[model samples]
Target: MAKTLDELLTVTAPVDLPSYDSRATTGFDGKKADAEKQLTQLGEELSNLQEKLFAGGRSGASPTRVLVVLQGMDTSGKGGIIRHVAGLVDPQGLAITSFKKPTPEELEHDFLWRVESRLPQPGEIGVFDRSHYEDVLIGRVRQLATPAEIERRYGAINDFEKAFTDSGGILVKCFLHITKDDQKERLAARLDDPTKHWKFNPGDLDERMLWDDYQRAYALALERCSTDHAPWHLVPSGRKWYRNWAVATLLLEQLRALDLSWPQADYDVEAEKTRLAGM
Candidate 1:
């Protein structure tokens, strides 16, 4: 029997970041054209499941929801996943939040306060471009917070995720893994094309200089926060097409596990039909 994608990609134990090949498409052998074709095939089932999920939530028939938390270094294609994968479902069914530097008001509250506010509603699929993990990732790397404070966040995150799962929410936490060489090439492309200049940032180079530090940060975050309820999947994102396909497949598997059905009519359907005929 074939292994499931979740089984293939999920971080079951502590990972040695240096050992893993970011460019290698782990567990998948199909070419780019094949991946794209598979993605198109995934669309109908994904759309149907999303519709059922949305309808169930809209009518207060189900409390189930999904939150896809995407975390990675710059140039990791978080936006691309949102555009290609989430685009397979209805736009109305998705709640995407692209986290940036905290605003003054956000800074005043606990880190999770803003994150909790932006969670997907019952039946919606929430996608976080960058998420609460930043507090630990950049927070540790940049020494933005006290050591003790950063230490406290790991347990806090586990508890928060536990509560979410206990409340019928499914969390899909993905770490988009890419190689340093892969990133350098991508950044170079951004600089080479005038049309892509808008995507280029000088500060990205500064971040690139701290690549080893960021990898350590990510490794720790993945090891600590990948819980039983919300395990993190390390996606090899060196190939854009495979990344899109894999994320979509992961989501499809989650939605299928829900076994959603069209909500039953709340009123007398036969009577409504007669009434409509009379009208």
Candidate 2:
């Protein structure tokens, strides 16, 4: 029997970040070209299911929605997944949010208040480039929040996610796994090319200085937050094509699990056809 992608990539055991290979294409034996072909093949199916989901939401027939939370170190290809994987579906059905630094208003409330506002509505597939986990990841590393406060956030985040899932949301949490060497090379490439200069941030290097701290933060987050309701998947992201294909495949699995069908016409179809012909 073939293993499911979820079974292959989902983080079931406690992770030791340093030991995991960043370039591994686990469960996929294909080359880059093959992965790209598979990603393209996923398009029609993704689009069709997305249309059904959108229709269900428009007609208020279903509350099912999907949320793809992407968290990774810089240059781990979060934007690439959104552009490739989420792009396979209709743009109308996707609500993509790239969480940035908190605005003054956002700072006034509890950390989750801003996140709650950005969740995907019925029938939509929501993608978060960087998400609430930032509060725990960067927040912990930078000591932006008190140590005790950071500890409290783990339970808070778990409760918050449980509530979202209870309300008919499907959460696909992914942590794009990459290595320090990967970041160094990518950043160097960015600096080497003037056109790519905009992508580079000196502050990113500042964060890189504390790479060990960030790793500890991430390991803790993954272990503490990988609950039954919303387990995180560790996606090896050094290979961009494999990362894109893997995420697309994971999404396809979730959409298929919904078992959605084209919504039935609420009005009489034959009568409508007859009326249209007469007109």
Candidate 3:
């Protein structure tokens, strides 16, 4: 069985990270290795199941849809997870969209408009790199909204998600949790490596300076938004390998539960076989 959101978050660490300003760097190398092995096995099983679903003509019949939202700070492996996990799904039935700072036209619409416009149709899996939660997370953290406004938006988001679930969409939201120390190390690595420099934004360091603020914002976001229908998974991401495994495992578990089936065939297989043989 897949780990429930509560169970996954309840597993105590050897050292509790500073709730507000974490600079801790305890490695989970052993756990990561184990997770990697488990992920490999799970990945194979998921691939096999997906192939059966597609080959059995199930893709067109049941038309189940999944929406996976990944949200975290800069360089939290959101892009990497998208590249790997979505690669496992059928390319023909998947859509991946990355949200950045709003464009001029997007600024004219409500926060959820851009996200709602990108929702996948039936039988498709849609991956959002950074999602509407940004409004709650960054918007609140940056004090872009009043407390009253934030509270109002919280209920709005809940209702929005409920509507999706009611309409046959499976929603999975993951918050990639990484320590400040790990983020610092990643930032440094990006600076040293020429190829990765493009990913290093000075603004990310600016945000790092307000790391404590971000954590508080995240804690509240998780508390407010995590629901019975659309819960949040806080994946420990100090280690990237473990992060990938955790996400892949969660996705595989959810997809496996979806019991996809093929449409009924109109013609008899025996008749078709005989007709083909004669030709």
Cα lDDT tens digits for candidate 3, 5-90: 33454323222335522222222335656867866776787676665554443335554567888988887889888876677666
TM-scores for the candidates: 0.97, 0.97, 0.83
Residue 171 in model 3: shift from native, Å? 1.4
- Worst 10-residue lDDT window, candidate 3: 20-29
Cand. 1 Cα-lDDT: 0.91
After superposition, the stretches of candidate 1 with alpha carbons farther than 4 Å from their true spots are none
Per-candidate clash tally: 0, 0, 0
Instruction: Give the CA lDDT, 0 to 100, for residue 21 in model 2.
Output: 94
* lDDT (tens digit, per residue) of candidate 2 on 79-158: 88988888888898999999999999999999999999999999999999999999999999999999999999999999
Angstrom error at residue 102, model 2? 0.3
Give the per-residue Cα lDDT of candidate 2 at 54.
92
Model 3 CA lDDT for position 170: 82
lDDT of 2: 0.92
When 1 and 2 are scored with lDDT, the better candidate is 2
In angstroms, give how far residue 126 of model 2 lies from its true place: 0.5
